[model samples]
Target: MLQINDLTFDAWGRRFFDHASVSVPPGAKVGLVGRNGVGKSTLFKLILGELPAGDGEIGYPKQARLASVDQEHPATPVPLLDTVLAADVERDRLLAALETAEPEQMGEIYARLSEIGADRAPSRAAEILSGLGFRQDDLARPMAEFSGGWRMRVALAAALFAEPDILLLDEPTNYLDLEGALWLESRLKKYPHTAVVISHDREILNNSCDHILHLIDGKLTLYPGGYDAFERQREEKAKVQEATRAKVEAQRAHLQSFVDRFRAKASKATQAQSRLKMLARLPPVSAVAIEHTTPFVLPSPDRPLAPPLVRLEGVTTGYDGVPILKGMNLRLDLDDRIGLLGVNGAGKSTFAKLVAGALPAMTGHLARSARLKVGWFHQHQIEALDPDDTPLDIIRREMPEASEAARRSRLAQYGLGAAKVETRVENLSGGERARLLLNLVAAEAPHLLILDEPTNHLDIDSRRALLDALNDYQGAVILITHDRSLMELVADRLWLAADGTIKPFEGDMDDYARFVVERAKQAGKAPTQIRAAEPDPPPKPAPARAKVPTGPARRRAEAAEAALARASQALADIDRALTDPGVFAENPAKAADLGRRREAAQAALEAAELEWLEAVEAYEAMKG
Candidate 1:
């Protein structure tokens, strides 16, 4: 368990937290939520003891362990498995101990050896490495060969292998594909230790966390539920506050009206003075500013396109001599909401660029439907914006035909007000630039939209807005985003660009994730299967003394015994069902029903078996 008391953090004269207090109990799974640049990461660092707190106490158990995967992964040139294995110092020591133990000493160290063999051996290392998407052959490769994204995975694997008591993850899912993200989600759910994660992916947080903590305006507020529940409650509270403010303001105005009218009359002067004093004592009502809502309207094409909005045939793309996409063939259909998935630097972006006509495809035929308008938003779109130009100016330049009034209206939709729109692009924050870029893309209304990492710098709300807009659009879209929640929400199909080929997946993102994990598990197992240590023995007969005296007595006893046996069999079935992930995946409704049935069956089986054993014992005592 960990606790923070009276924590305060300040940066450049701006206070992020003032006397904030928070506690994370053992085995607690909590999410740290806030707007962009609100010091979520800073608070995490403060807890981590990496930075000195301005004022407060951070307390944890003496033996408590902590580990984290930083937002910016450090550069490393090591094989992925080796990097992960480096975290488990104890595992290495145990392995060494087991290897060097003498034959005479082995018996005395068997208990220690068993502990290591069960949980800390090379098998565990291998299992975790494979679970994280690393192949057996890749384990021995040097870490220097992997890209930034793969390097980040190495760091993640290290943190996981550390098996600390508390995990502080900052955007762990940022670079993960749907498969990797889902595997992480599964692991976190069953993880024995507590975790406090700061993430922009809504689905990951919602699926993995049991509680939500919001840090806003130097205060900490805990919500006793997941992201969806927290959002609903926050919205309701805001509405109530607005209503209360309105009512208070109306009463204050009524009191002021009485004073204004009666001040002229001498006899009413005293009463008016009393009312004025009362009005002055009333608390001032701060006006609740309405958030500017941007209405994103994608322009409808005059004509709809047929199949194959974009196509790539025999494409070979890569830097230098390395080919990422080799003789690749891909076709994007009209009105298809396609999700491009693969590991980092796996030609996803290259394919996107090839389709957008931003890069040349070597020895390939690139084609697009005639009259199809394409609007492309790359991952580095912020760099594309002019630092000197204000958002208003950019919008005007992009939409020259639109009236000045309409241009401002479009900007307001993305939370850019009239005053802020005039601010220079350089002065705007990363999240602001992200919103502006999305707004610019929405203004074009192209029939085919190709976006690469569109949600990179967006906050939770802005990501939702962009996702909603894309969902409503009736055009062909090829989107590449690391936000798994956004992909699941908007994508109708998936295209996995891996190992020089693009494979089309004809289901939801969940199905694709399941497929990948199952495949990885199968790939990790050896071809040979070890036989069981021993086979089950045949059933035994009942004792002769326990035989019933007559027909009715025998029938009742047989019925009871048969019912007990059936219950025992049912318990065994339930145990087997729990091991099969497919049982939960293929039949959710059946799975839910089986859970309760399993508990009931188990209890009944236990009671019946106990009674049967007791009966056998009593019979043996009487015979003796």
Candidate 2:
């Protein structure tokens, strides 16, 4: 268990906590949540001992191991698989010992390997990577081969693969697609150790965490159950606090008025004095700090939208002239709300770029309405902001002829008000910058909006605000984001971007999620395969028959039946061995060996049963 008592810390000339305390029990999955700059990461740093606490004590089990995702990874020649596998320090230590141990110590090394389950480390690492959207070929690739987002995934995979006693994940789903996020949520559900996940994804927090730790106004409050429960509890608490504050203020107002009106009168002087004393005795009530909703209201388009705002015929383009989309034909109606779906590195962003006119098609006819004004947002655009310029400064330059008052009014709608408007771009948080970008785009009153991962850095409140804006938006939207909730709420049609083509998905987001996950599961050459990608290629047509003698088909069915019987018997024997206490108590080495053997036997039995079923089906088809 990890215990924090009255923990207090100071950073950037501000004291974060005065007497905040919270306890994380063993195997507890806690979701840490708060607005930006509320000290969630600072608290994590203090727990990790990277920052010294100014007051109070934090205690944890002496032997507890910790694992956390790093935001940056050094470029290296090490294979991605090896980098992730190295996260298991115990396995690495054992392997290191093997290289230096004496001949007599070989048995000890082997026994330790069995105990640690190091034999399956390679496959385990690969499984984790594939779940995070890495292909079969990516495992052996060098770390430098991947982009920054992929490297972040590697960091997450390494942290999760470590299986530490305490795992700290801050925004782990930020860089993940819906499929990868769902896969991760499933994995976290089965995690056996303590974990604290810091995320803005509602579904992830709701499904993965068992508890919620809310940091508000320098005080830590622990709530029971998941995010939904926490939100309910918080709302209840806020209502109760508000009611109490109202009563207190009413009484205080009555007393203060009496003192003000009659304090100088001789007849009522004594009564006023009594009222003052009574008011002083009453406890002070501070109203709860309500959450800030995005004040960023989007202004409606100045002109009516025309149909077929964008049209592409025989579109083709790729990075460095390697065509990704060839002979593609797509049209965007003024009211179109299209959501792009694809796995990582599948060119979703490339398609968005092509539509937004950020990238010229290698060979295609691109047409747009004369009144079409595109508001294109991309991840790279965040870096393009001038570091020295404030949000207001940039807007002023963008709308040169507009009055200063107009620009400030527009930015104020985005919550940049006065204080944030003058702040340098470098000083703004990612979420703040995202809001500014949205505000800038909204100011243009464009007929078509192309947003790529616009909500990647936004908080829940900001996301809600954006969702509301999109629902009310009159412009055509071409969106590419991993936010499933947003996609479901805003998208009118789903488009699949894969296999070097752009096409409409026949089903909803759930169907697309399943397809992407299946793709990942088929990633590499692994011993145990997930359900086959395409499913048994529509079986061969059977010959028409009324009745036939059991001949070669019967023989093959009989052989298959025999194989299944043998496999089942072997599994039963292993199960019986596992149930015996003496088998494990007498020999730890033997027990660990049996455990691995049982898994293999189970897989073999499954395969054997499948083979038998196929044989029976074939025989039945032949008879038909």
Kindly list the per-residue Cα lDDT of model 2 for residues 231-293, writing each as its tens digit. Answer: 999999989999999999999999999999999999999999999999999888898887877
List residue ranges in candidate 2 displaced over 4 A: 250-281, 522-624
Q: How far does residue 348 in candidate 2 sit from its true spot (Å)? A: 1.6
Q: Candidate 1: which stretches are off by over 4 Å? A: 71-78, 93-110, 116-121, 239-308, 311-333, 359-366, 382-428, 441-443, 523-624
Prediction 2 TM-score vs. true:
0.79
Identify the leading candidate in terms of TM-score.
2
| lDDT of candidates 1 onward, in order | 0.73, 0.81
Top-lDDT candidate index: 2
Tens-place lDDT per residue, model 1, 1-624, is 888888888887799889998877789888898888889989888888898888888899988888888843455666555566667776656556778888887675666657655344444555555566666666666777767677777778777777789999987776676557777777777777988989877876788888888888787877877899998988887888788889988988898899899999999999999998898888775654454334445554567787778777887876666677888777776657788887555688888777777777677787787777888887577887778999889888888999998888878877788788899999898888877776677565688888888877777876777776776676778888767788866666677776676776444565556655565455445312222121111112234423221222222344457779999898889878877899799998878888998989988998887766665555455435
Which pairs clash in the backbone of model 1? Answer: 77-143, 77-144, 78-142, 78-143, 78-144, 79-142, 79-143, 294-413
